[model samples]
Target: MAQPFSVDAVVWDMDGTLVDSEPLHERVFYATCRRHGVDLSDLDAGVFVGVHQYDVWNAVAHRFPPTVSREAWLADLDAEYVADQGSLTAMPDAQRIVSTLHAAGMKQACATNSAGVVVAANLMTLDILPFLQATVTLDDVKEGKPAPEPYARACTLLGVAPERAVAIEDSITGLMAARAAGLHTIGFASNHHIAAKPEFHVLADRVIHRLDEVLSLVTMPAAAR
Candidate 1:
């Protein structure tokens, strides 16, 4: 049984955790790279999981000809992603977990490395915005994941101390950010990008294969401690 710990708030990672958009993102990223004449293998996509799109753009720019403007490449990718929002869906148990937490009177927020534009589009598409009290994006922080700034800023925005919050993540980078912020971390392994990583085993406080299992943590008596 998981021990209970009290938290005034809960923070979430948007892409793979709340929304089943990882596969879509991989597809879009690869397509975008191909359009820019940059080739990325499946292994490359897996390795880049959890990084910000701009970071990926920078890397892609380095690999491709300098003639490819980073801003243009990023803009094209963003446009494609936004257009595909209609096909986005909430992860299994995501809606239920968020709804349950809201009903339980716990503060909820989304802290993601994605840009605000992307975050807002997906949140609206998945219809999970009503349950989110705060939304922090890369634009809101000086650095992206693995830096802890985003997660720290999110805790500040929620008026909750890091130790009094729980974070759900699906990537090693996201886990590192949440852990660095001193928040309890739960790793969701539903995404192939993270499922294959050995680091996840020791990085997260707990790991769950389905989004619904997340509710178990919130309800666990240990979580209320």
Candidate 2:
């Protein structure tokens, strides 16, 4: 028999899950890499999808050798993305679902591998910051996604047990972290950037094609599930 789950809280992964920023991320990263003298013509950008920005930098720096300091490269990328903030938009039904969950008395929080500054910007832009009762950013956890610390911290802050919460993630990396933290995971596949992959579906406890689909899962009674 499948174990019953009672969800009282929803933990969200910000980047590709709630915000449509992966294209912006890829553009900035590629430009930054090229400026730093790294040749990526032979490499597919998809490999970096759903990956932590810092981890991507570290891996690329190690593999190709960096002509610029990692810190400098990161600063440039962050600045560029921030400057292009007008391009950032919430995922389809993102704000509606978040507000609906909040109205339904769900304890909601965001756990992301993005830096604190980036998190603030994205949340503010999406206008969903006020609905999130708690937020765990990359700066809040020493070990980010794939390590479980981010989601663990978010659950702790929300005062919810891991098994009693549902984590919505768009990347395989984030799914691993949510599973490690013992939260029921939903793969948000609003776009083809990352969660559309088979590995994501395999890892997620549930796969949702639209943000509104989350409404049913979180609202369903434990007995029904």
Give the TM-scores of the predictions, in the order they appear.
0.92, 0.91
lDDT of each: 0.83, 0.83
Cα error, residue 84 of model 2, in Å, equals: 0.4
113-220, model 1: which lDDT tens digit per residue? Answer: 988778888888668788878999988888999889988998998888999898999999999999999999989887765767789978889898987777667642
Q: Which residue pairs clash within candidate 1?
A: 3-222, 4-222, 4-223, 5-222, 5-223, 6-225
Clashes of 2: 0
Candidate 2, residue 199: Cα displacement in angstroms equals 2.1
Candidate 1: where is the Cα deviation over 4 Å?
A: 219-225
Predicted structure 1: lDDT = 0.83
- For model 2, the local distance difference test gives 0.83
Sequence-dependent TM-score of model 1: 0.92
Note the clash tally of each candidate: 6, 0
| Root-mean-square deviation of Cα positions for candidate 1 versus the true structure, in angstroms | 2.4
Cα RMSD of predicted structure 2: 3.1
